[model samples]
Target: MVGGGFAGLWAVRALKSAPVRITLVDRGNHHLFQPLLYQVATAGLSAPDIAAPLRQILRRQKNVVVRMATVSTIDADAKTLELDCDGGNETLAFDYLLLATGATHAYFGNERWAAHAPGLKTLDDALDLRRKLLLAFERAESETDPDARDAWLSFGIIGGGPTGVELAGTLAEIARHTLQGEFRNIDPSRARVRLIEAGPRVLASFPEDLSEKARKQLERLGVEVSTGTPVKDITADGYRLGETFVPAKTIVWAAGVSASPLGECLGVPLDKAGRVPVEPDLTVPGHPDIFVAGDLATLKQANGKPVPGVAPAAKQMGKHVAKAIRARLKGVGIAPFRYRDFGNLATIGRMAAVVDLGAWKFSGIVAWWFWLLAHLFFLIGFRNRSVVLLNWSVAYWTHQRAARIILGGDDTRC
Candidate 1:
């Protein structure tokens, strides 16, 4: 493992029962719960609540060894992996290499704004966003100038995917209901949340009716949803979408993603998005000893459409790769990896969500309840799930966010 995202974690879990000696290497020590990363940014949850130490999680597993290191390059010809550690460079040889290294937020050709508007993919990013959001409110409350106050209160979100939509909705709820009575001079309720989507509709992957319903739910929460609008530029003050300039102090980018550079390091054939092109068995072409899974690999189905880069898909790929490795080691014929779609769910706000399960489609409070339960159930540990549930229950009843403290950092240093 070269990454510690959902894919890498699942890959390790699936390979636990195998007889292979697994050495999992990642930059971070903990495996983060990415779906609820928005909650961390919106101050509904803390870092430790959604992250488990990698060492702690696999401590008792005899076949697994967790190393906190960054992979610099892979000598595929020599079958050696080069890693950078605290002390010095280290190399390890692998009979079967599995690349679960995942994707990262793409800046859409403008990498400069990454410093100003950070995307939430890791625990550190979430904490930074939380700090920026809460600090904006605190600064806005004390600002006497109307224009500056408005700029401070304005929040801009790019993209209309599930992550972007959920963040926009939760932020709206926080500003309107949670912090309504907290501020003295500033009405946090008046804070602007503008969601920018270049596509024709939000949640384009979901059903058209469900997308419309999500849009309505966002509007009800006071979020300004702008579809078919492309953000041309971003600055310290805000972003420029063609002729219009939206002045927002806090900007969240959830637009696009690109696969890790590990694939390039291996010199494998990659798709347009820089993902490794894998066979139906999830093995790299010409290298049956090496397997690629999760976001790092692009596998096309019989219908010619590429597999979706969702958590469930990544988990399924991880397990399939592990099984294939085991089968190959036993000298048995391996089955081709097949992805099973497990439906999609996206929450707009409190008591508002949309779930599509092929034959069955649900919306409104029931969908929201299901979404909450499903997320809670997927959380790694019992203690984490219990704490998250307790926190959510308190927030639901009291309309207050518990982790709204703002640490210091300007837009330039984000």
Candidate 2:
């Protein structure tokens, strides 16, 4: 087993009951709770609050071995996986392999702006964003020039998906409600949050009605939601969207993502997004001994729509692959992988959220509560659940964010 995101974790859990000797390899030792990463970026939660050590989580499972190493390549012809350890190189031979290597943020061919505008995908990214956001405010507090102050206070979020929407809304709340009276010179309440989307509507995966509702809710929160505007260029000064130039110091990219290059290493057929095209059983074509899952694999539904790259879908695929591997070992006929749609949920700040459960659809505060509970329940440890609940409760009652301390960096130029 390779990769240690949500999909990889679930795969290890499902394979616990099987007879295979599992060795989970990943670059990091901690498993991050990714959905709430925006909260971490916005200074609502700390890194340790949202991540769990992989070895600690699977210590009791003797069948699994956790290795911290970077995968160099996958030599399918030799049935060996090459890895780069801290001081040396190593290789592991396996009878069967599961490739759950995840995806990375796609810069839409403009990879140069990654350093200036970081994407929130890991705990490190979240902490860096937190530092940048807090430093911007700090710089704006003492900035004398009006133009510099305005640039420092303006935040730009690229994309209108759930991640982008959540980030924009949370930043709005932090600036307007949480930091309203923190500084004497700068009125943080006047901070601007602009959400840019090239598509006609935000949350294009949702229904038209829900997207409209989300737009209205975001507007109410003081977020400038701009649709049908594609960002042509991003620089340190700001970003260019067609004829308009928005001078924002802090720019976040939540727009696009591409699959890991493991498929390319294996010389397999990949989709437009660079995801490996997997068989119905979640195995690579012509290499049934190897499997792929999560955002790295492209699986289509009966309706011809590709399966979403959400955590639930990845977990489902992981479990299915584990089951197939077990059946193959037992000399039993394997069943085709089938996805169970459990609906989708997106929250807009504190008061509004949208949930679609196929036959049942919900919105508003009630839906927001449901969304909160579901995320808390899905989080890994009891400590994390308790701390997250406490954080939400305090934020709700006081309307103040606590984790706004900047770790390191100077934001005067930002």
The lDDT leader among the candidates is: 2
Model 2 steric clash pairs:
none
In TM-score terms, candidate 2 sits at 0.98
Q: Write the per-residue lDDT of candidate 1 for residues 1-414, one digit (tens) a residue.
A: 667677777778888878888989999999888889999999999888898999888887789888999889888888889999999999989988888888888887789989877898888889888988888888898789999999999999999999999999999999999987888999999999989999999999999999999999999989999999799989889999879988888899999998887899888778878899998998888887787888889988878888999889988888887788778888997778888988999998889999999898988999999999999999989899999999999999998887876765664232
Clashes of each: 0, 0
Q: Candidate 2 on 1-414: residue-level lDDT in tens?
A: 998988888989998877879999999999888999999999898888889999989988889999999889888978999999997999999988999888989998899989778998888889999888888899889889999999999999999999999999999988889987779999998999999999999999888888998998899899999999799999999999898888989999999999987778878778878999888998889898999999999988888888899999998998888888888888897778878889889998977888888788878898899999999999998999999999999999988776977886544345
Which regions of candidate 2 deviate over 4 angstroms?
A: 410-414
lDDT of 1: 0.88
